[model samples]
Target: MDTADAIIVGAGHNGLVAANLLADAGWDVLVLEATPHAGGAVRSGHVTAPGYLSDLFSAFYPLGYASPVIKRLGLGEHGLSWRHAPDVLCHLLPDGRSVTMNRDIEVTAASVEEFAPGDGERWKNAYRDWQDVATPMLDVITSPFPPVRAGLGLAARLRVSGGLRLARRLLLSARELGSELFRGEGAKLLLAGNALHTDLSPEEAGGAVYGWLLAMLGQQAGWPVPVGGAQRLTDALVSRLVSRGGRIVYGVRAERVLVARGRAMGVRSAGGTDWRARRAVLADVPAPSLYLDLVGARHLPPRLVEDLAHFRWDGSTIKIDWALSGPVPWKNPAVGRAGTVHLGADLNGLTRYAAELACGELPTEPFLLAGQMTTADPSRSPDGTESLWAYSHLPFRTAWDAEPVARQAERMEDVLERAAPGFRQLVVARHVAGPADLEREDPSLVGGTVGGGSQAAFQQLFLRPIPGLGRADTPVDRLFLAGSSAHPGGGVHGAPGANAARAAIARDRALTGDLYASAIRAAHRAVYADR
Candidate 1:
């Protein structure tokens, strides 16, 4: 008899989403997580003092707002509640000027006016053109990407005015896009800062796409955070699974997906317990860990092995967290209320950061993506304190010790200090994590490539990770890839996981439970019998 309908590895939001869907369909499901907690990078905790809730990794959730699955699942009823900041984000230039974006198009435009007077009107034009393509643009981005069928579908769906502009937007680098869309330096910096959220420099192609998309989406949905914290989102997902009779085991790692006769059975945890699922095994882990380490080499196709060998992770990131006595007091009062704030010296500074990383050297002036949780929702911290977290891209494989933490963080503080002088005096506590810590906490974060590999033109769309394999499926019949590596890459959307579960369930019906179980025993016996 099948132990469960499906065995899922890693209880990240995607894994949970897949498990919940399977269970709701009346199939028994089991989810196993390596860490002591579920949610992966979406976890939230009080890393500081009592009552100061800090999101350990991701803070902003534009992708979460855009996710079709989140709506379909009705996660809000469980524990997730969203709060939006009036000003979505700000880019603090070295000269103390800032570029801010808000829902009111004219108001946001006025902020752009700081660098150049007429640029505000020009920016409003960009937003109007953006709205024309927003629906289809979202379709192309959120759908299993490079779905030629989907792309063709979108091309047909858009009848709005000037939809052709998205085609042009695709061709420009972030720098080019910013320059063409707005004449204000602050406006250009805001776009560049938004694009860099993907770990790409403004100079990189396709990077600018996010700048416009994120900026526009924020205007539409607002840069929202769950009222309690990011964990509330994860908790809601897990609750749905439990409500459906699904089971989850935290602190459990699946070392391999046992296979036999060219089909998958279930998974064997790193601790040596074999959880047999006679139906299917869906992995919500990274591609490298799932394909090479968990699934083993013999079952994989030769071409797939080659693709795995060449797969690229974006770059490393340095994260700094702080417990502050008060909200970050931005000298410019307007920017103080923004949820997400970016700090950079100049346009050249950003280029240099990317250039150095491309050349395998760390930049002197780092590009920082900082989040002011308390500023947006004061409840995240004590009544008068701020719980803060920030991150920035570093050289792809840089081995950073405590030294770079000081160097990079000092620069970050310098930006804030310039914008809000004496901001350092309010810092009550601090913790900094290098790339190694990020990878150690979650192997999927491999090399701190937060975007689930580069969003580079070469790696995006049908070409992601490798061509012809973006559906969360592999050569192995019952094993599936359900992480950001699959498609609609990164952010908090669980579509990749949902898509994988559907594929696995379909196959489960085709192949008998015993066939899957036998495969697991055989694959496990062959690999582990020697000991």
Candidate 2:
């Protein structure tokens, strides 16, 4: 038998979560991380100043607050505490005005009413309808994929009257849905900006659902930040995993997955050590790197190889952090108290920003997603100062010079100056992490495409990475896609890793001994044949 029951490649948050579950259930688990740290996008460090802790990647997590998995893990006991700002999200408009949404429904409705007279009633009506359908959808969507039983349960739900109405909207663009819901441009811009959180355009298919989901979540739970920093969340996860007998080895990268008899056995580290597994091998790495570069097509089905070829990554983003002398002190004071501040006035601003990014031109006036991260948590910096971080999505893999970050910062200033004049005066020190810095941190980010493969309509759900299969089960029998590229896809949710773990458990429990050979043969036929 192998050294452990399972070998997890990449000690990212998702892999750690899966390892924790398996280990807690009495499986011996070993985690190998390419980087020297445990957290991937969840990393937090002092990049700006010595005492000031800056989030290296993802900072605020609304998902963290809402995820059942995190709650089940007892993360709060393990050092995960949340700090929420006054408002959920703030949109700093270019017309020298701003709108802030609160966690309470009536308060949020009133905030929107400033822009549209009776739109508050319309907003409430939309939310009322959304609530009827969202609770059930949230239950299933966020839950781990159940086998055939779960599928039928969801199918039954969709057959119901309320679910059918929601499903119809899922097929529409956020632009269409927002336009139908509100008469004011302010409300439309808010919905549109929220939809593009994954960097999907407002006009893109399947974008509406994200807007609806996030808006609902924002209403339900204002986005929250971890008390100590995001690293505390990682530390808690790692602690829980280790407490369950899962071992994590830092600074180890998987060079290739070990395949035998058409089944994944384990992985070969770049350091030239071979580790074997008795039950499963879960990879939290990106799709192309895991399938093409590391494992190669010899061990993969031909159609899967083609699907890997066609996999699309959500564009790159530039992450910037600052150790400010004081709070943002925005000209519009309301936005300063928000955890997340979206900066873009009207539809034209966003469309122009998208056009410039598409045409290989970083906008002269960029749209920024700014977060007053430290204001939410006092421990992030000194008592008087506030820590700030922001990122702007860009076209994927755009080739640029060594100091493109400096240019991007110049444009970022334009966004900040519009809402918070003299923003530069507030900066004590700044740290910039662009595409190159991102790739350097983790090759899986792949030019700062943090969502793994794109969340675009064609690359999502069952169609993600490939059609006919979306639940982490790859064409290779025991091999599975545990990264965000898999089903229920990206974000810091850890669903993909959890899905892969459950899939592995099911496959192992069923077929009694190695089902690798039989499963691969069947997968080959299904993939090659037309759906």
Least well predicted 10-residue stretch by lDDT in candidate 1:
522-531
TM-score of each: 0.91, 0.95
lDDT of 2 by residue, 1-531 (tens): 237888988888888888887776788999989888888889889988878988889888877677766667888778888888888888878886776778888887887888889778888888887665554565566554443555455567567775567677887787888888998766776677787788677777788888888877787787888888889989999988877778988888889888887778888988688888888888888878878866888877676777666877788888889888888868888887788888854666877777776676676777888888777778888888888988898778745455776788777876776677777897889998888888889767888888887777898766766675567776666777788877777777777777878777877777654554466457656865533
lDDT of each: 0.78, 0.78
- Stretches of candidate 1 exceeding 4 Å from the true structure: 145-153, 159-165, 508-531
Q: Report the C-alpha lDDT of model 1 over 497-519, residue by residue, as the tens digit.
A: 87787767666664575565455
User: Candidate 2, which segments miss by more than 4 Å at Cα?
Assistant: 143-159, 511-521, 529-531
Q: What is candidate 1's CA lDDT for residue 153?
A: 60
Residue clash pairs of candidate 2: none
| C-alpha RMSD in Å of predicted model 2 compared with the true structure | 2.2
